[model samples]
Target: MRAKKIYWWLVFSLSALPSLYFGLIYFLNPRQLGIDPVEVLLAESGQWAFRFLLITLLCSPLRRLKLRFLSRYRRMLGLFSFYYASLHAVIYVVAWIELDWPIFIQDLVSRPFIYVGMFAWLVLLVLAATSPKAVVRALKKRWVILHRLIYVAALAVMVHLWMQTRGAIGEVLLYGCVLFLLLAERLYRAVPLLNHQSVGKSANN
Candidate 1:
């Protein structure tokens, strides 16, 4: 029990420190962020959001590989994804648009990427809100169905990133490949043939 607590504490610290450092740098030394600090912060937060979402999805594959301990940290990683996503939205509203509702609505209409990103954020919001143990318990099997929307949210994020990029699609392609593999692994596990193979192997053993 002590070890598990220590492991999660380490995970939380490692996950949070970079965000905290960037936040402080943005506020205390805006000059350090270059001329486009708002853009930099927005990208940084959004990237972290994507990363955490990927990590959350990776947890299941890792568990299948026998790293069951990772399951415990999945919820924390998912919540962190939402945290950075919310920060990204707040920066867009407060810093970029300066809370001008008219401009905000206009940008959302003008930028299809913004629309996709916001939709993804909304799905993350739903997942985060229902992440509590009590809520999960109450939802029962339905919780699993609702949380499966993470895959959709991830696809939306990739599209959001892809649309925002001008040239250099290398990074986007890399992340997309990773998402593809994760999805493939999930499908592989779900296939009845694979299940039967596993059962046969166990029986033979």
Candidate 2:
């Protein structure tokens, strides 16, 4: 039991380190961020948010490969994704828009990427809110359906990134491929014939 507690502590600490480093750099050495510090922060935090979200999606595939221990860390990874996403939103509001409601509203209307990104963030907010044991227990079967929105969130994020890219689409394409594979795996498992074949192979192994 103590070991389990230690494991979670380690997971949380490691997950928090990047945000801490980013925060320190942003606050202590704004010069290091170059002329477009706000843009830099927005990009970095937004990238990490998507990265963590992908990692959260990967937990299921890893578990299927017998790395069941990863399940314990999944919630932390998801929550960290939400944390970075919230930071990304905050930086946009404060640094980019300077808390100007009129500008924010205009951007929401004019920028489809911002609208999509905000929708993804809202989904993450809902997932994070219901991640607790009590909430999951209360929701029961409905929880599974609700959490499936993660895939929608992932799709929205991909669109958001694609729309935001100014030039090279290499990174966007890479993430798109990864998300594709993850979704494919889920679909593979959902099909009974394929799932049975996979189970047979696993048992034979």
Candidate 3:
């Protein structure tokens, strides 16, 4: 039990390394991030958000592949995903936009990608808000239905990423492929059960 606790702490610390690394760079040697540190921060945070989200999505498939212990850390991974997403949003608003209401309004009107990214972040916000054990217990079966919105969030994020650039299709495609495989696994598992349910219903009829 003590060993398990230590392992959990280790996993938690490792999971936080990305943010810590960025934080230290920003504080210690902001020049390393280039001249536009805010833009660098925004880009890195957004990328890590998707990376962590993809990793969180992988937990279920990994468990199915016999690495069941990963299931225990799924919630932690998901929260980390939300953490990076929130960080991205905060940096964009606080530093990038500098709370410039007029500019923000102009961007909202002009940039469709911003709309998509905001929607994804809002979904993440909902998921994070409902992530607590007490809330999960209170929500009961509804929790599963609500959490499925993570897929929508992931899809929106992909759209947001794709919209951001027309030049580099490679990075966008990589993230898209990872999300596709993760989603495909869920659909693969669900189809058989859905077919079985249909057969059972027909037999009962």
Candidate 4:
């Protein structure tokens, strides 16, 4: 099982290598893309971040189905989500705004979408920082409470993506639909009937 988990991470990391390679190409040769290079970077980073957010959300649903032991990789997926979000923010600041203080402040205050994205990233930061087993042990009950921030973070991420997309929101709507279904699944399975069945199985074991 441990070997299989390591292999999965390797696969994801290898697949992500292309993104890094493209980023470098954009850095060394901005004219490669017809659009602004910074815009390209931002779009890519944001896309991957959302993809990872969805991946993290899938862990629980997959677990319920008794699919492979995905819970072990939840922290990895979560940290990757945070990593891409940070990259997105950095590109926005360094490439887009050139780290302009006044403009940064203005956007943060005036742009509701930016605010939501920023809040989501902040929550991811806290979660990623405290994901260590030692911290989880020390925090005990509080760990569970803090982890609830994932729900809020997911909402913020979806809203951010929805706001960023221009006309014909088909892609955004599709992602929204999937996540909505995921949440519904979680709720339906939370019923006492399902809980009783689960408890019964545990007792039998």
Candidate 5:
């Protein structure tokens, strides 16, 4: 079952390759799409960014629901989230900024919100690189700590989406609600009652 889940994830992602292909082609030649190719790319990638972000969060909740196999592939889904985010950043730079390095640098410096997005991406790069088993074992003590950075990543993504499109507050609010609920669930599960019960059991032993 777990193997099939992973297989289907690959299949699903493969199905989306056409979008990436056209996105790239349209990027190289803006005249391909009758509509604004850049807008289409941005919208599609942004939707994907949020979708993957939600999936990453859903890993835990789905596991709580006894869908245990999901945990096996959380890292893969997370890396995909970062993948779409990177593409979103590329679209912003290549399509919107038109590869004007100096102007882009200036914009990054001037725009407060871009910092939010960039910081998230930086953390994501670290997370994606360290997703392997060897690194996780090597960083045993630090592994869990490092992965907790995903909360910050999620926040950064929300801010990125909120700021990038001025009127997309509805979508932003929806993501915000989901994130808040997920974090709250974690907190609830970590309550003193559960901790105390565990401690008492350990002491009795």
Candidate 6:
């Protein structure tokens, strides 16, 4: 149990390193952020958010491959994803727009990618809120259905990234391919169970 606790702290700290590093650099070494610190923060935070989200999604496939212990960290990874995602949104609102609600609403209307990104963040928010043991118990089977929205969030983030960064086309494609494979694997795994259910229903009928 001590070992498990230590491992959890290790993962929690490692997951937070990116944000910590970014925070330190932004305050202490602002020169490193180039002439556009706000833009740099926005880009870095947003990228890390999407990366963590992808890592969270990977837990399932890794568990299916026999690294069953990885399943235990999925919630941690998912919350970290939400952490970075919130950081991204905060930087955009607080730094980029300087807490200007009118400009934020303008962006929401004019920048369609912001809409996609916000949708993804909202999904993450709900998933994070319902991640606790108590909430999971309250949700019961519906928890599974609701949590499946992670795929939708993933796809939306892909679209958000693609729409926002034309220069990073290669990175976009790489993440897209990874998301596609993860989604495809999910479908592949579901097929046999679905077929079995169908057969059982037919037999019953």
Between prediction 2 and prediction 4, the one with superior lDDT is 2
Q: Across residues 146-189, which tens digit of lDDT does each residue of candidate 2 receive?
A: 89889999999999999978889899989999999998987776
Query: How well is each residue in 1-205 modelled by candidate 5, as lDDT tens digits?
Result: 8979777678467635746786778858867764687877877776686677677778877877888665656777777777887887898888888999998888779886787878888888888999898998898757777887888888887887788767557877887898888878776866864656553322100
Off by over 4 Å in 4: 1-12, 15-18, 193-205
Model 1: per-residue lDDT, tens digit, 129-155?
A: 999999999997778878988989999
Candidate 6 lDDT, tens digit per residue, 101-197?
9989998898889999999999999999999999988987778778988989999999999997766589988988988988898778678767675
Ranking by lDDT: 2, 3, 1, 6, 4, 5
lDDT, candidate 3, 101-204, per-residue tens = 89888887888899899999999999999999999899977787789899999999999999988787999989989999898887887788676755332210
**Could you estimate the TM-score for every candidate?**
0.91, 0.91, 0.92, 0.86, 0.81, 0.93
How many angstroms is residue 181 displaced in model 2 relative to the true structure, after the best TM-score fit? 1.1
Between 2 and 5, whose TM-score is larger?
2
TM-score of 4: 0.86
Steric clash pairs (candidate 4): none
- Model 2, stretches more than 4 Å misplaced? 193-205
Q: How accurate is candidate 5 locally (lDDT)?
A: 0.75
Residue 53 error, candidate 5, Å: 2.1
- The TM-score, computed over Cα atoms with residue i paired to residue i, of candidate 6 is 0.93
C-alpha-based local distance difference test score of model 6: 0.87
Error (Å) of candidate 2 at residue 79 is 0.9
What RMSD does model 3 have? 4.1
What are the runs in model 3 whose C-alpha is more than 4 Å off?
A: 197-205
- What are the per-residue Cα lDDT tens digits for candidate 4 across 1-205? 8989787878568647747776778778877854677787888898888888888888777876787565657888888888889999888889888999899999999998888999999999999999999998999777877887888888899999998788879989888997898778766765755657653332100
Output the worst ten-in-a-row residue range by lDDT, candidate 6: 196-205
Better of 3 and 5 by TM-score: 3
